[model samples]
Target: MEETRVLLRNKDVANMVDVAVSMEHGGYVGLRNALLMDGAQVIETLRDSGLRGRGGAGFPTWMKIKFAYDAGGTSKVVVCNADEGEPGTSKDRILLSTDPHSIFEGMAIVGKAIGAGRGFIYLRAEYSYLFPILENALDSARKSGILGKNILGSDFSFDIEMRSGAGAYVCGEETALFESIEGKRGEPRTRPPYPGTYGLFGLPTVLNNVETLANIGPIFANGVDWFRSIGSENSPGTKLFTVTGNVHRRGVFEFPMGTNLKDIIYEVCGGIAGGKELLAVQTGGASGAIIRPSQIDIPLDIDHVASSGGRLGCGTIFVIDDSNCVLDIVKNTLEFFTNESCGKCIPCREGGVQLLKLIKKISEGRGSVIDIDTMMDLSNTMRETALCGLGHSTPVPVLTSIANFRDSYDRHLDKDPCSKCSPERGLK
Candidate 1:
């Protein structure tokens, strides 16, 4: 049987290509039937599917659910982390805006599997346009008996509310999100008690990314074998990539996990917005490492990207052309991390600022050999000492930039300026 192709736009053609048709075409009806029969069966199907988390770490989703289920709690909470603060990443917004119903259904299925009473969709404030759509979908699902008391006529009850994040990037982290939802300042907490054990007001909580939860409805509608057959053995199912930067057809695309990076850039996105040659592609957002064109032909799945010293961080692809300055871009990225650093930790709070200064100095032709050494030194310390992912991954782009674009920095040090940053010489 051929694999099913699902996209946000598929909902727009709901008259012809409905979710049922898509799931049936993809061999997912069995899972859906199993879910309707009993929630325990859905858990078994998910365990068989081997679906891991897609947000970043790629932890097993089933295990996360099992942990929450065994937490011995009556008031468990399900949270969908829609706060996508990663720069150059908009795929979550796309999913929320277009295929919200899928997410809603997924949340419902999860609430059933874990015996949860309430669920929350924590979306970023930037996605204000999607607020009405999500609210309307939840309201519609409730009225139609798809949500609210006794979802699908089962004893399981769930009510979903959409919560807007007030522009905090750290809130993307699960523990911080918990604090934010409680009307407290968003800051990551120390963990021995992971969210699965103790979260969301000291209750067992299962928090998943928007894209991760979006896959749930399809998983229930389709069987484990069907989902396993689509992607790689470890990273199964279709993953969404928000293709941006210099790409002609720059937008969100959903493809199987092992799709070629070259195809995503050249074939799917029409090759870098023009006839310009591809220099590097940012596989993730600011925290992602850059892959040179020589590495473009490599598969775009998590394991493959990791093998190539890159990550499928949120699957945000940025195609960089020769006209752009890698140094400037890296500096800007550092500046973002620096400005957005919640200042909760001394390492991230201070290190991000220091790295940005060095990058800016290099980009402005004011850096010396010592500056590069200083940047590397601080990056090493930050990587080791930082308290959160922000500090841990902050230096990824900086280090990758120096590795791939050493010559750019060298040229600036040699008192030669690139066309992009030659403004110090005042050229028109």
Candidate 2:
């Protein structure tokens, strides 16, 4: 199916980087509309819209605004999480590099709604090339009277600053992003003081990723009813999927929420790269569930993926063909998490290395059946006890691969292995 473009807009328009081009296409319409409503009214409008965060969390957008709004602080903050660090995910970068004005507009609207005076866009270090593009967009917006003091000539004054991360994957986590923005080491913080109540500089903050913020401009531009009518009942509005890995057409595509995974793979992605037999599919991120082909028919929405034992996190899809072994693929995922772990907590710091060791053992044709069972036990413990999502979710791919593709693991137990199982090129 063709992309149902709502968020990805006006690629054909010349000089899209210029504010005038964005204005030509009804840009800042949402901010103009939002500025008219009271903070509580804005929150209620979002509630009626049924918008959830496009980030991995799948949290209700309205609720986040309400939390920061109801936190009842004069000095609140709005954060745009542009740190798109998840493996196989590039949707945020696509939005920021192409449609940057909308992001700034969204942040300004949130600042007005929550009574925030200043906002920050935490751009990932890997995306430093985008800094100038974003800055150019910001300068254009400010000059056009869309940002800076008294936006659009209103008394409400708000401005946004851009911050760059230092290439830490853990900074993708909300709290870690805040820490990095504060000139500290990027590491996840303890809960009970969530971003809504106690956030950046100890101010009540509303934090949403780039795609989630981008949706705000469109939702108000076209009525909320239009957004709600497009996607599933629970998950309203279009979703951005970054399709990569062994696909004939690998890029960002937008589809309504609840689009069938089978259709996404077979049609949207143009089947596998070379008509190869599809072996497995990994959704969400590197640590997302390893879904078997038989399970691909299910809807690709937050609730559906959760109910079906997967995560629709960041809307990334990694397509694996028959040539690669599941064990090797999972080993690579574990290795990434092992390297990315902040080492602040014991379970994740120690468990990652231990999990990597076990996967290496199993992939090298050195394991018995007991090793499989042992890995599961260790993964469960980490999931339940880890300090944050990094530790909790690190084991998802391993556990999901074990549950869905047990035969792959069993094959490694045999002395004679298939061509797909190679120990030398364990992880790439």
RMSD to native for every prediction?
3.7, 1.5
Please list the C-alpha lDDT of all candidates, in the order they appear: 0.77, 0.88
With a 3 Å backbone cut-off (N, CA, C), the pairs that clash in candidate 1 are 28-221, 28-222, 246-272, 246-273, 248-273
Model 2 Cα lDDT, one tens digit per residue, 1-428: 87788888765566667888999987899999988888887888888889899989899999999889989668999999998999989999888877888899889888888999999999999999999888888888889888888889888888889999869899989998889999999999999798889999888999998999998888777878998998899999889999888888898899999999889988988898876889999999897999898999989899999999999998999999988888888888988999999999999999888888888888777788999998999999999999989999999998999999998899888455446655664332
Candidate 1 structure lDDT: 0.77
Q: Alpha-carbon error at 248 in model 2, in Å?
A: 1.1
Model 1 residue 370 CA deviation (Å) reads 2.7
Distance from true location, Cα of 81 in model 1, Å: 0.9
Model 2 steric clash pairs: none
Q: What TM-score would each prediction reach against the true structure?
A: 0.91, 0.97
- TM-score: which candidate is best? 2
